[model samples]
Target: MSGVLVIAEHRQGELREATLEALGAALELAPQTGRQVVTAVLADDPQALAGPLMGRTHGLRLMAHPDLTAFNPEMYLPVLEDAIAAAEPGLILMPHSSQGMDLAPALAGRLGLPLVTDCIGLTYQDGALTAQRQVYGGKVSETLVLKPASMYVCTLQGGAFEAPETSAVDTAGEEITLTELSPAHARRFVEYVAGALEDVDIAAADILVSVGRGIGGPENVPLAEELADALGATVSCSRPVADVGWLPKSRQVGTSGKTVRPKVYLALGISGAFQHQAGMKNSGTIIAVNKDPRAPIFAVAHYGLVADLFEVLPKLKDKLAG
Candidate 1:
């Protein structure tokens, strides 16, 4: 194996942030394993995606095809196979997004390579691959050791690794041409349907004030929102809050919801279930308030207050106002 191959993901003619996060993981592992890093970007117009990715990888492979306007397993698999053959990578990684989820398992099965999904941490030692992932709803972690193969495939979790800086390395990635390609066809590219308009993008927020069932009921959601307004933070909620129609599903955070890495995550009246923790545990600072001292949220919080959020939130809001 000459290097690690990172499959760059794009949609609607633009690169995804998760691709950068996957690249960052590849770069981190390259030095330790003494292997180079290569990135493959497949697009209808591969040139348009090169600007942001230049000088970052040991090599760049661009596969262009008209049918690649959007990601489909049938169209991408052939080009990906060619890229892997050319790169001869020991490991292949992509972000665990919708596309990755759709493509990785089939690709690994076709190539007879072991596969891991939603891996948060990775180690390549003596050519053996070990992956770390949260299990039992993030209450416990499990490590997987795969049987040896020529190459390994994995879809990594987003928000687990930092995206690489634009000017981190000087090795300008030279683009490789994919020619005379005949792709397989089973699924066709379809129009992307945008979800309901979200009022707040909690994933991009600098700070988040989130509530849960402990907030009492839908009426008290405004209290959390008021605190968020005072702190200039966005209001988010646990799955239960959204399930009960207290908040929109877009504002919910958990395994089934958006992953966020805010600068500060203030969990108010939230018991901090493992599922909820999966979404915001990566926040820079975690301050949790719950009447239950044994709330699981405190395990990941930098600061914990074992008091009634109703009383504390009002006083804290006043403190901030003053």
Candidate 2:
């Protein structure tokens, strides 16, 4: 069997946490399928790769090229497609970020392979690889299996896998080989538009307190902010909050907003809409406070409180303060 390949995602020389998570998922699949796990990095500077990936995986391969300096789909697609052809990997794992969403399907189309997007879980049974993915806005989980094709590409949802710990491998001695290829298409990145809060990223926060429509109106956002302050966590909002301008789009969390895997996620007055929960279902410990017990958030929450946020939040904050 061919080995499993994990595509390393980096920007400006920094490795994204999702890459390690994908590596961990790939490692889990490797033992079951009896295939070696290899990580392929596409970057200009090969020396900037970090984390315990070197010692943990079976091998590491780097594809360095000047064209990869900026993320260009036309340029990246051909390079990744060529790498896939050369490696003939049984499974190709990628982070389900914006870039992955754009490139995975195109690559699959080019290679004539089946592609799965936003996979939350992966397992093997009866010698077949199965993936658990959310459908209908996360209202349902569908299991999918791949055929005999050697190439299977999937984008993993953020926070789906636990971050792997670094091993004692001599990364300094590891040598990376580069592949040079010319892009068939030409497109240039004009400029990058920065978000309002450049330094504040909700995805990287450890604790998040998010608000939803159940909070009433934009006037009630202060209550959520107060709760966030009490917990020493960042404040985010559901899609409705952003759509109504109660919160900035930068602080939105859901399928349309930023996907987060915080250590502790407190959903106050959020009814657990599928679009909203898709972004936060991977939180380490989820606590949802809603008056509607039938709210879908409870399905994935570790702790649920069926009560009015107006009454419960202030008291909870007071108790925490005392």
Candidate 3:
């Protein structure tokens, strides 16, 4: 039971993508750290939650309770405490999302364990685990090594690691556990309200035609729209474009905006700064269009076009439309 334990995050009857990414990060560090990877899925019927993680992790610990249907910190804390006692995990990994942000700190404080959040990468060396995070608005990266603590808790940043694929044959048997919990006193469970329906959520868009400062001005934003329409893709932009009010903040993609993992990300006029890349680097197919051949964006682009976006935009639109 002295292995790594990952607290799986799920919502709306489905596991979040961040959970799989956290699993990937944990599996990557397991070999060097000499810890087996175990996942903890807590729900009213934990068995129902085991499908996605089957064969993707080294082990599974399922905690089931009727009160655990929704995410309530009060109910979750007791279950986690019991799991920790039973599993004796060397390290605990959680998603750096709403749920993990709320649960990790409190759990760490209560357990008197070291905790690191929003870690973009994890490395194990010299018998120590190091976590990497962005600093100064993603201008620089800082590494942290927590020592003297027998165990540590970390929250992995979303979209930082690739999602692991699931298999059918190599599923690890799950261990069923239970925890007793009183009703939530601080906050009671209420109905879940969905966010307002927007014209498009760039994060959910499969294909994104994103513009940058190179779009020149708001008047030229329509050019990106024309191309996006031709490609049946949503139009998103970088921070600078949103700063200048050429587009809504919701359309911005970067550290300061929403992260996107579109299948085809068309970066027009983007310089490929780390801030912007942090949002779309995981996109399945990245095609960067910029006049500067030396732009940093080309480094991550699967396809790079070293030409003026203005000239290429129209031709590309026509070709796609054809």
For candidate 2, write residues 1-322 as lDDT tens digits.
Answer: 4768888887766887788889889888877777777787777765567455666667777667776766777877776776677777888898898778877888888888779888889875554678998776455779988765556888998777876667722333234444565666767767666656643689988999998888889888898888888888999988888889888899989876888999999998887766687789899999999898877789889999999999998998999899
lDDT of 1 by residue, 161-202 (tens): 778887767654555555545656566656887657898798
Task: Report the Cα RMSD per candidate.
Answer: 4.2, 4.6, 5.0
Sorted on lDDT, best first, the list reads: 1, 3, 2
Question: Whole-model Cα lDDT per candidate?
Answer: 0.84, 0.79, 0.83
Q: What's the distance in Å from true for residue 180, model 1?
A: 6.6
TM-score top scorer: 1
For model 3, the superposed segments whose C-alpha errors exceed 4 Å read 125-127, 163-179, 183-185, 198-208, 212-234, 238-279, 282-299, 302-322
* Native RMSD of candidate 1 (Å): 4.2
- What value of lDDT does candidate 3 attain over all alpha carbons? 0.83
Task: Give a tens-digit lDDT track for model 3, residues 252-277.
Answer: 88766888999999999988766688
Residue 133 lDDT (model 1):
92
Q: Which candidate do you rate higher for TM-score, 2 or 3?
A: 2
Total backbone collisions, model 2: 0
Displacement of residue 13 (Cα, Å) in model 3 is 1.3
RMSD of 3: 5.0
